[model samples]
Target: MPEPIADFYAVIPAGGIGSRLWPLSRADAPKFLHDLTGSGQTLLRDTWDRLEPLSGPDRIAVVTGRAHRAAVERELPGIPDKNVFLESEPRDSTAAIGLAAAILVRREPDVIIGSFAADHVIRPAHLFDWGVRQAIAVAREGYICTLGIQPTEPSIGFGYIKKSSELIVEGAPEAALVERFVEKPDLDTAREYFADRSYLWNAGMFISRADVLLAAIEENRPELHAGLIELAEAWDDRERRGPVVDRVWPTLEKIAIDYSVAEPAAAAGRLAVIPGHFDWDDVGDFASLTKLNSHGRGNDLAILGENARILADTSSGIVVSQTQRVISVIGVKDIVIVDTDDALLVTTSENAQRVKGVVDALKLTGRGDVL
Candidate 1:
């Protein structure tokens, strides 16, 4: 295990219903609450485990929706009640992470805060730790740093980061100046980027000094910064916290941290990126879930769940069963069957990305009870 960074504090943004991984992931119980990887641990627990070595259990905090506070607390008993920052509603990543930074800065001014997502999967723990160490080195120098993953394939699922030049930081030798962040592209554009070695997958992992992050937010989104500051002021106050959050939480602008801070910082040459040498996956959809299955690599079928009784003869793909159902596949290929107690989703891996549309249609049809 790598030595813990004394000033480093880790924050996890654990919102999002993960609509793409529907049936298996729901509104009341999001994907982070379940063990999607078949690793016998929920993604939230895995995330806490990953950060514990670096931040220690006490230095880590979690930001989640108000509805999920009890579940998240149940999953992570090591996290203190004070560290579990609950949002009244989903205000996107900017407000969620920014509030944590603002509140943490009040507690410890010189804190180096790293905001990591709660549901992403990263392999070869040592490499991730090293990447974070390097990011911390760069972050201490006052630049907003993000860990960028090397593109293993021309995957359009993730955003790309363009690195301009090498940063001559002492500890972070491979760190580079970020030119800009690009959205998920088409196949041709993704291929072009893959051919060029300057681009990396933006994993949405950011590490920075708490004050520096707040300043960047202040520069780009003054209104949001002001509201967050106001909320942070009353955050620890027992008397004023409740009334203030109820009044100000929903009024804050619902924007991603990428748009609110990262892009602007990149434009101003204040963004740095350290290339990560570890394998990463956001597990966005069932297709991604197929890839994360360790036993499904070369096999015709991959099965998730202890009680899942899937008998596939020649079918190739993934099958997830949350109940005691005997699911059998004959000759279908790339099929995805997610069988839960309340919902059953049957689709192909080709249409896995379109599963979110099903959730949208369900909501439009007033079938949110199943969602």
Candidate 2:
């Protein structure tokens, strides 16, 4: 077992609604609160399990929606009430992570903060530990370090990080200066990037000193930096915190950290990439969710829920049930059936990415009750 890194703090941003994985994932109850992997642990809990060993319980914080405050608290009992940063409204990653950084920096100026997403899946815990150690080493050297995953295929689903010359940081020998961050590309471009050893999948796992990150954000996004700093100043005041957050948070810019910090940092040669050698997945859609389930992969099908049985002949797909009903499929290849008490999602693995469209339609039709 690896010991906790000294002066290390972890911030988990768990705010997204995950519309793509709907029926199973809802607005009030996001995918992170459920065990999509059938691992008997919710994604949020699994994240805590992996990170608690590195930062220790007291050094970890979670930034989530106000509506999810209770659920997040219930899921992560080890975290103190103050460590749970609840947003008045979703202001995207920049604000979520920025506020966390600002508060932690105020608490401890020299603290190294690592921002990890609440719903990602990383395996072989030991590899994750080593990668984090490398990132921390690079971060301590005043570089904003990101753990870039080794791309296994030409995946157009994720952003890519272009790595430049190797960074000779003492403790992190394999660290590389990041060239730039590329958005999701065309399939042809993805194939080109995949063949190149210089590219890695951008998992958005950033490790840096809290002050360093806040400084980068301040340089790149002054307005957001000011608002966050203002909020952080009042964070510890019981009476003033609520009023300040309500007044300033919504007015803040709604931009991702990539736009507000990482891109600018990369251009200025302040960003470093530590190649991560762990199995990881964001579990963005049902198709990827299918791959995570042991029984759902390969020969036949994947099924979620303990008593949920399925009757199928010559079919290959996944079935997730919230109720104790037997789902049957016939001659349907690559099918996906998600049955809940209120809603049922029936589609193919090919159409997995389009699931978000359904949620949008629901909102348009004023059917948010089902959402």
lDDT of 2 by residue, 213-310 (tens): 99998988899999999999999999999999999999999999988889999999999999999999999999998888844356588888867878
> Would you estimate the TM-scores of all the predictions?
0.98, 0.98
**Once superposed on the true structure, which residue ranges of model 2 sit more than 4 Å away at CA?**
294-297
lDDT (CA) per prediction: 0.93, 0.92
- Worst window of 10 by summed lDDT in candidate 1: 291-300
What ranges in model 1 sit over 4 Å off?
A: 294-296
Model 1 error, position 354 (Å): 0.7
* TM-score, structure 1 vs. true: 0.98
